[model samples]
Target: MSPYSHDFETLEDSLFAMNIMILISMALPLLNVLGYFLR
Candidate 1:
């Protein structure tokens, strides 16, 4: 039970990291478009 809980915690952390990465990936393209329009 303890090991399973530990694994679950790690999985949650990884999922959080993945979400952050996905947001950044999405933002980069939008930022580029904004910059191009501003220029």
Candidate 2:
């Protein structure tokens, strides 16, 4: 593959990883809040 495609692939992978991390972080806090309210 071309260097440009390789760079884009790496960048896309990184962005996807970052998005997953953010979602996990958000979900944990939201769950904690719900648990506190329920309990």
Candidate 3:
């Protein structure tokens, strides 16, 4: 396998992780608001 491909895979993994973090960050506040309203 090529070194460039390996680097690209690592970059993709990091981006995926960042996306998950961003999604969770966005979701938490919404969840909190939902819980507050539901309560």
Candidate 4:
């Protein structure tokens, strides 16, 4: 495999991971508010 393709693959993987982290960070605050209301 070419080094360029490998670098692209790594970039894609990191971008996917970053998206997941952003989603979790966004959800956590909403979850906390829900929990507070339910308590």
Scored by TM-score, the top model is 3
- Candidate 3: list runs displaced more than 4 Å: none
Per-residue accuracy of model 3 over 7-32 as CA lDDT, tens digit each: 99999999999999999999999999
Per residue, candidate 4 scores C-alpha lDDT tens digits across 1-39 of: 999999999999999999999999999999999999999
When superposed on Cα atoms, how far off is each prediction in RMSD? 1.5, 1.1, 0.4, 0.7
Each model's lDDT comes to 0.99, 0.98, 1.00, 1.00
The sequence of per-residue lDDT tens digits that candidate 1 reaches over residues 1-39 is: 699999999999999999999999999999999999999
Name the candidate, 1 or 3, with the larger lDDT value: 3
Q: Which ten residues in a row have the lowest lDDT in candidate 4?
A: 1-10
Question: What's the TM-score of each model vs. the native?
Answer: 0.81, 0.78, 0.96, 0.89
Model 2: colliding residue pairs: none
lDDT tens digits by residue: candidate 2, 1-39: 799999999999999999999999999999999999999
Poorly placed runs, candidate 4 (over 4 Å): none
Model 4's number of clashes is 0
Kindly provide the TM-score of model 2 when superposed on the true structure, using C-alpha atoms: 0.78
